[model samples]
Target: MRAQEMWKVSDGTGITVAVIDSGVKDVPGLEGRVLPGVSFMEPPVDHPDQKYPPHDDFDGHGTTMTAAIVGDGSAGGPQGLAPGAKVLPIRTSIGTPMAFAVGGEAAKGVRYAADHGAKIVNLSIGDWYSMDKIRSAVEYAQSKGVLVFVAMGNEGEGNNAANPWAMLPGVLGVGAVDENGDPLPSSSHGQDTDLSQMGGKVLVRCKKNSDWCVQDGGTSVATALASASAALVWSAHPDWTANQVARVLIQTAGAPRDGVKRNDYVGYGIARPSQVLLNHAGDPGAPDVDPLAAPAPAKTPTPGAEQTLEPRAESAAAAGLSWQWPTLGAVVAVCLGLGITVMIKRRRRRR
Candidate 1:
């Protein structure tokens, strides 16, 4: 493909993607491009309202993944798949060695996104199983028409079953691929998951004022790549529903297997976002119909699931300004006209 070919066709210009991970740093390429995000772990202290801050980066992982999805600046790393799209960084993970510890942060991020109005939610996280709170969050996003994409987890070598979070109906589970288009050792696999994208070896934004890049692997990268792909597709086909986009991804995935058969390793083959963005894939069926409607509550936090207050919460700022406003570009007219684009953020900031 041409340099930023996907970007030219669709730069995720109006899309607002939430980066749920170690806070994102404000890199030169991403400066002005990223909006104030949420930080759940840190107490805002004087800045009580801002649980999350704007253009923050901490462990470098969030920024790296953010670059894959939205960075277009040639600072010192690889350009993003969708340079024009805005990023809403959420400090969901502390880059901890364990996964359960971050599940709370991820849950907080999901609630914030749905409440704020992000159209597409990008979670470059793994190990947040698809059980109670997590499933509720995913269900809530789907009810609001938000298309949530998550990393399929980096347990492929350990024979980890497809990450349950990815298998959730409305959620898009992505796997990792090397530069040569082969599955990575760490990328998880499953059948119910959405698709696959480039996750193995690549460069990313280091931080603000620094254009330096680094090499990395894991489903986290794949999730970022897939998030950018969704932004491109959503930005172009403004009317397409979340289901339609998801259906296209599955229909056009790299390898097709009989039924929903998932290998103990790679999931439903690899996701080919190019197919949907390029309109080469088949229709995603119903616009109003949801793939995740069976088990979970229509919106979540309904009956049996545990309920908790958001780690942080804030009013929206402006149209296309919130980490939850993934459809900002698509709904800018509606939001601006209604003066409803209040991009408030709750949480903490890092780096």
Candidate 2:
């Protein structure tokens, strides 16, 4: 989304997005923008001997995501898509560790965010595990009129299957694209992916030094950008429900493919919130109807399969990953020309 076009209409004021991740620190660009929230990862659980405070960023991931959503460009920092929006920071993990299962805390975070006046929740975190409880939380948030955005994991090296959260029907699974608008190789693809946005070489605040910033790449970053764009659209049309906001986003998104509904690679094309903001180019459809709801039951891939990027068993999920990015100074190093890398983390249990 073009920051210039979006600023001409709305700056995401009066919108509160719940960011469920590591945690958020009070950096210069987001001094007052981050609201106090909860921390699910604590001592004797996910980690030992340390308590993750509500406002502390353990691995700097949450701070980066918070900047993407509502950074004000203060102290010479990069501007976020919704500089005027507020972020509700909630911690669910500590960097790449799988200390506590993501299913339980994730569900609690969603409900807590929705109950605490968060109109949109940004989940820029995921693993290979599938949990039914997570799906129920997504559905509950939708029913309560809150939009949830999840990142398709960065496991493109092996033609990886979609993460269970990304494959959920009610949640909006987001993919990453380079500045030139090509799909990022690490972005996972699947039927549940709803939109694509900036996820590579993105500039965000650093947790080590509040005044400094860093360059990072991942679907985790992409999810925050997409959620920030949603903030812009939702902030502009405050009267619109969750369904209307989602519908308009799908309709106005850029990149048209043969299929109007979904694209395995880019997921209904790149998100252009400006089109919905300035051009009034999207239809908000039925307020009560969920555009992402799955159709009648049909044969589907088995939920559990070999978690690899190579051609998998026919019973495995049919999602693949690809790469591309231009104009970003710090691209993910994993994108070697015609080469692939495999990154894996073990979850306690498979779906």
Candidate 3:
């Protein structure tokens, strides 16, 4: 990713990314950076004792993702890809019973972020089932000119089933790769995957505390980095529309080794933000023409209809390493790759 060099040119200033996940805490590194947002999940009826606030993290996964995107490393936490970017923390339940009972929570969160002042929305979660409510929300975000990035899932070595959110049109599906620039076996793949990034053996802030830890790799981490990469590019080119920013990311990504235009494993290749930030590469195509296919028309929600959705497991793999701060100099480089090529489909554009 050459993040250090890219920072010299643009440290993601004037950009706000919405992190829709478990929740984000006001940890040391993220003290003044995390903006207050809403929580879609409430305490379950059966487990009233489990009340998690919007700023509270249930699994620490959200905090880690937040840190990866914007942590300043002030308290020995992991350095963010876009240190100057601000984060809007929107909390949603994933592994809770309330998540299953409350359908369209993710949709609500996305809409909230878009209505607010977020230019980018990062969804580091995935679900097995596809819900119309969520799809409509994603389309709504795209219509609002907000870029949404989602994890493709970590079941690559298993069923590798498609994640509904990642499959949504106009959303950038992200996959994971390791330090060696090889795709991680656990990173899910499909035609929807638009980019890949360094996720394996990366350092992150632990849940419930400010300590640093290492994550073996997950599409969740890759997705957060992809969002931050967009922040860097958008920060440098504030005048560019969402379509133009998306175009540059795809155009500047590393080409696939097989010489094909795109592959299931790594998409266009890897997202190389440095190609645009440091080297002044990539073409910011037409501001109105979407680089990815345009999204389908949004369906109107039924009035007063109470929708319930089943929550799928999160895309992040369990943390394998124990919490401990390692030497900062020994940290592995967070390399980003892959770019999107314009593959416009003949779908009806959203109004």
Candidate 4:
């Protein structure tokens, strides 16, 4: 990514990015960069509008994502792509597998981020059931001139379950790719996928302790990195609207062939913000037009469509971006071992 060159042009200064996921904690690398964040979960009475260490997320996923977006790497710590950006934490989950499985609260968090002055919001969670409330929240954020980046999900099979956020209009659905710029099989595909980015073995600070670091990757990680890339471009062109930033990215992305427009696996192509910032090789197009949506009015889904609550939150593998949904046999084994059935169907959004 010629990160040094990009930094010389812009370090995401004067930009605020909201991380809507598990809670983000106050770590050494993000001393003053973290703003006050709120939790949408109900059980924790004092979690809302907390200063730092907002929620109970022992797994460190949320903190890892935050570090990827805005960590300054203070005192030889892990450095984020957009060090100059500030992070606003929106805790939608409390780190338990059950809490991570819930999907309805994400809509509320998206609206909150837009209202709180976040230029960009990153959603690293995926759910099987597509809800109107979530779609409406996405529309609200877009109308407010906020860019929302959502995870395309991490299911290797082409026949994964449905993801509502990936189907939403006016939001950027992100897929994962390897260091070689090849699409990982785990990265979900769909008409709404806007772009792909490096999500394999990304270096980030561990939430358990800021001093320690880990290599993690998933569609979740890719979404955070894509938001950081937007922070860089938006910081450079502060006057540019969300549509302009997206247009510039789509226009300058690396297509497989010379004239290829888009494909199912990688969408427009790999995100190369350096091409826009350094080479000045993209047109912002129309500020009022959406780069992904059709010119005609979008057809809204009928209320009370076929929807079911999925109960499992899968984890991204350590190597590739793929995640495994426990098979029936595996579930049985787990039940036998634990003496209780989790009864949670993981939402795989590969479709």
Kindly give the number of clashing pairs for every candidate. 29, 5, 8, 0
TM-scores for candidates 1 onward, in order:
0.72, 0.78, 0.81, 0.78
lDDT (tens digit, per residue) of candidate 1 on 1-351: 222344456768888888777777766566677777777654435654544453554456777777777665454555777777888877754543323446666777888887775778887664423245666777777777788887777666654444455655567667676655556666655443446666545664334424554445467777776777677778888788887776666556555233332332334446555556555566767787654343211121111121111111111000000011111122344334223211211011000
Candidate with top TM-score is 3
For model 1, the local distance difference test gives 0.57
Give the residue spans of candidate 1 off by over 4 A. 1-3, 42-54, 96-101, 128-130, 159-162, 205-214, 256-266, 291-351
lDDT of 2 by residue, 1-351 (tens): 446656768989999999887777776777879888998764655447776676987566777778777877666555677888999998876453543455567778888998999999988775433255676677678778898888877665564544546655567788776655666676776655678776656565444435444454567777787888789999999998887888888777764334344566566666778789878899987887776664222222222111112121221101111221111212232233112211211111111
Once superposed on the true structure, which residue ranges of model 3 sit more than 4 Å away at CA?
Answer: 46-51, 101-103, 205-210, 294-351
Query: Which of the two, 2 or 3, has more TM-score?
Result: 3
Which prediction has more favorable lDDT, 1 or 3? 3
Error of 2 at 351 (Å): 25
lDDT for each residue of candidate 3 in 80-106, tens digit (9 for 90 to 100): 888899999888775454555333667
Better of 3 and 4 by TM-score: 3
Candidate 3: residue 301 Cα off by (Å): 41
Candidate 2 Cα outliers beyond 4 Å, as residue runs: 45-50, 96-98, 205-216, 257-261, 294-351
Mark the 10 consecutive residues where model 2 has the least summed lDDT. 317-326
The parts of candidate 4 lying over 4 Å away from their true place are 44-56, 74-77, 97-101, 204-216, 257-259, 295-351
lDDT of 2 at 166: 66
